[model samples]
Target chain A: MVTTVNLTALRRDIASLSERNALEAQAPRSAFGFGDRSIDKVLGKGLQRGALHEVFAAQMHDAGAATGFVIALALRSSSDQSPIVWLEEDFAAQEHGFPYAPGLNHLGLDPQRLVIVRCSSPQDVLKAASDSLGIRGTGAVIIAPWSNPKCLDLTATRKLLLTAQQTGVPAFLLRLGAIPIDNSAVTRWMIRSNASRSSGANAPGHPVFDATLIRNRQGMTGHWILQWESDNHVFRQIEPVSGAVVSTPAHRPPQTRKSATG
Target chain B: MRLTALDERAAKAGLFKTMALTDARAQFENLDIAFASPRKDAALLEKLADWCDRYTPLVALDGADGLMLDITGCVHLFGDEHQLRRDIHQRLSQHGVVVRSAITGNAAAAHAFARHSAGDVIEDSALTQKLRRLRLVSLEIEDVHLAGLKRAGLRTIGDVEVLPRAALAARFGAGLVERLDALFGYAHHPISPRCVVPACMVERRMAEPLIVMDSVERVLHALGDELFRQLQQRVEGAREVEASFFRVDGEVRRIGIQAGRPLTDTKTLFRLLKERLSTLAEPLDAGYGFDIIRLAAVRAERTQTIQKSLDSTVQETEEIGGLIDRLSIRLGTGRVLRPHPVDTHIPERAVSLEPAVHTAANPPVEWAPVQHPGEPPERPVRLFQPPEQIETTAGIPDGAPAQFVWRRVRHTIVLAEGPERIAPEWWREHAGALTRDYYRLEDNRGHRFWVFREGLYERGQTTPRWYLHGLFA
Candidate 1:
């Protein structure tokens, strides 16, 4: 009787596991991959479409990097050439400068495909986000609020997520100088600027991001150092130089030992 | 000071306008007097003219105190001319305003009759005979001209009419003949309405005023349907639409919306109007309720009749257009913007944010590519307007900054690229302008910034100042 009971317990576990798998299969599986092998592996199939994703600047000064990362994601996730709507708050635009069209063109985004909705406040940003997310043919929606506002509560984000899911348009909430809080986003990311590999003459090269996946509802969290290849419109993993000589550490061994002792 | 005007009691006491205030007070010891403000009177007259729009769309201000309403073809709606005149008089009286109204075949005759002989509705055949009884002063001519006519012994319009036309023209000037002909209904003088007459309009007049918001929306929907049908019959669409609400208390409220494209769909039109009404800064006040609601296409354009296509792209375009219109109406048109490439080389002026509604109608602009293959972007992702000044320490007088202080934060420059010099446009009148040497800099913390040095290190000028212009990703 003990053997039979153990066998039944094992069968029940298998049954539940299979059921979960089946449910996951039935869920909307339309996703867009990041094209990077390792990042895509960590993201299962890739970032799910028609869901809410939050991107936070790791530091207040890294807002430019965070914005670039979000733009890359939007370009990757958009299924077609449909227009992308950007909901920007007035405070945010004043704090960080306005998005430049020539820069957007340099980043492989057509200026004509961008629709900017300048909202007066954080509340208006969320309102416009929800409106754009409900639109069927919209490529993507990026909601950039200045900072953590009281109106950006869990309830508001949940509403945005539900609307995005219903309309199959992905929504990205970009926060500058804000900490990650509990919300209904499918994925949460913290992004910071990474030192780009220098080209000839010690000049800064392509834009590089140190992106940390803080939360993922359906997959494992990971980190990456990504270099945006604007010409090809893809994110490439930053590879170490093949035959570069290593330089000495800036801090000497005696100084490091004294600090450690303290 | 002279008294500019008088009330009925003061007028009955033999006090005339332009009489000295002391004389008026002497005529009546316990006189009630208030200062007359012609400016305020003119403002009230303008408001009264707006209120009169409920009767006819053509309402113009006559002088400072009178309103000229051309009620042609509108009288039948209010039963007849006599009833229309009585209704206007009764309604205005209810508002505590004493109004004198007259209907005539022409505006000049009507103006004379209303001021000199109140409550006269003259037919086309009787306009001349009726106008002849009015005094020449009622013509509203210049004071000098009126004195000339009086010196010529023309006491009434009858005396002026009996004179020869050539003699009258030669003696008093051609203006008198023109005025006489206008009064006799021999010439037509159309009144310039204060508001633009709509290209097409449909209105609903209710016996009971509508106080509920839902009822107003329902009426708007029906009106939209009617308007769409009218537009469809003419193969036209509305570019600009206006909905006017006539309140029972003589308050006229109008809400206008502009479409990015020629809109022919009734549902989209209703949705846009509803969105605009809901987002109004001052919510619609239904004070005493609205008695008449009219929908008009102020600007209509001829549109091609296109067959419904099976292509999904066409349908998607239509849906997106509708969405743009809805958003523009909700959040003001200026808030909804798209990047428009300008023809200048100045970074800030390179891309201008234009209202999306207008830019959508324009052909897409060709943006010059500023990126180079296998290299980082030449331009920064975000550009600050009027670049912020920064303190910097440079190794050389003209070299890129070695370190910079921005926003009270010190950043050590690790790598930098440029000294791409941009000279100011000398063709334009920009005084005290200097050349700019820009550099792309990455700080030790990996934050990238675009900084510039204004003015070169020349011999006879102030030291060049450093400024942080943009942020790069």
Candidate 2:
């Protein structure tokens, strides 16, 4: 109360901090990309490497779509020497078919490079995922749970994120037919199958996905229609179609509400 | 009641072996003695033999009360023959056991000399002279033979030695001659060790029982150094090493470490063993602490001499193999794995995770060839075992489904292809088994599904149940 305070200087400090934050968010810290504008453009930066991403589907039939979405992301960052390891936490193999090497080979992905770890419970799967992702050169580790397990709490999610970030390896949590609550993942995606476009009377077109960003740290929640190119191992943008929208309290873009008062 | 044996203190108080326990008590009025059980004595002898194994692996039971140690080539390890004998005597004395030890070249001479005269290493040339002066009891011959020698006025080994060999044999039997030959270092005397003798072995005897892990580790390190030295001499390395810890309370715990390749360096050997010890599910139990620890190379192989250079590719492979070996020790051998391929159409049976060490030695695996070299895939990337049963409705009886309800979700198929028929192998499949008709169905939501119709609808069958087997990219 006794000293004169510069309100203009204080305002300048707040503006400069926000500017630095916006610039810092531009580099994804070594994350790999999905090669799709709908995701990359909204993120402002690329997909973050050495971070955790959570993905879940709404129904059992959509479980396959959820898994494919994660596999595409994992394979994008993996190589023949250091491939992705998938930890099957529950009996998801019975629910959504095991990974077939022949089908994978046909898609130009080497199944031999993939290592599958079958664990008994969700806790064991998370433990295995944490251990595997902690390996320095291991590209990515995937945890696929058959259902929404009550055992996956916030602390467990944070542990996975810490290990992945410490070792500089990405970790993907694939939830089958289960909506996940909030945790430490830098990004959370709810992926579901979108109706495919037909090229001819009998020929099927490219695989398409209705991907919704549920949680984003660097950007805002958005929805996009993405198509998978099997030959190129990339995802292409598709024109937004009707009825691809999922509603749940209409997540407001958090950054848009900021009033600069400039 | 009768006493079978007496200790020195009781004997000093006018007690003796085979005397009536009541009579001995009556004589001293306070003779502290108990009925000697033979079983307890045998157990003690067995433990003593196991304890003596730390000296040389060549320890065997001489009789009810004696242990024979073949100290040949092992004497230098404890400084010299006399020093080893002194050390053994001192250790036993400290254990409250009255012990007499003789370090000799021959087992029989050592056995005979340990009881009479001075328990010392007699020169090889003076062995016969030393035997001549010993009493007949020293020869370790049967009691009947000793009795016969006494009756024949040959009360000592010299008396029997002077007699003609054939005459001596004719009188006391050939057993006397074999005993003389063994005692005089003229015949072979082999000892059957209680434990298997490894290719190379090193051991450490603790003066004080080691109850802590650090002490065990220290002993293991010391023993591993000696073993590593021996392995170096043969220009070979140990492929599998076994470490045995003998507890003071008579329990033996063994830990074994297996390497992906032959390992000789002491640092690597000790490091691997330490990792294995720490990772054991049931940790090493040292009840009452261990008195002796032994390190032995159970198996060995010729180590390939690599031309050491900055060639990192070869080094990387070796480093990875080492990492796998370390991990297998902790996570179990089955947990650490490498993908191996099989030449089969059944997907589950086509690929499996094998122990990483097995694949580490073999050449890189080649995945199955693609059907259409470079085309966008029409099949799903992931396939599951026991294809999941899905409720799908088809237009024609044998045709693919235009719409299907799976997991409570109905999808209308917009485009579909494939009727790739896969019949179960005739020899492997039973008669009435269905030949599968697989179809790639693309629902309106671009959800690609691999649905297979089992058996033909015309073959006296109900509605052919469709199973969803895979999901393509």
Reference interface contacts recovered per candidate:
0.68, 0.45
Cα lDDT tens digits, model 2, B1-473, are: 78887787887877777788778777888666665688999988988887777677787888899898777777777897778878888877877889877767788888888877668878788887878989998877789988888887777788888878898788778988988888887899798777666788887778899998887787788888889889888988887889988887655677888877778788877768878887788988888899888889988777677877875556645655565566566556675565667766544566776776456556658787666553446567677677878888788777889788877788777678878888776776678777888888877555788888888878877878888888865
User: By summed lDDT, which 10 consecutive residues of candidate 2 chain A come out lowest?
Assistant: A253-262
**Docking category of candidate 1:** medium
Q: Which residue pairs come into collision in candidate 1?
A: none
DockQ numbers for every candidate?
0.50, 0.28
Model 2 lDDT tens row, A119-207: 66777677667767766656578888667677788888888888877766788999875767878888999887765555565756666
Single-chain TM-score of chain A, each candidate? 0.83, 0.78
CA shift of B393, model 2, Å? 3.1
The residue ranges of model 2 lying beyond 4 angstroms of the native Cα positions read A1-28, A145-151, A197-205, A240-262, B1-202, B221-242, B257-281, B294-327, B373-379, B403-412, B427-434, B457-465
In the range B170-284, model 1's lDDT, one tens digit per residue, is 8778888998888887898899999999888999998999999899989988998899899989989998999999898888889999998888978788788879988988988
Worst 10 residues of 1 chain A by lDDT: A253-262
DockQ of 2: 0.28
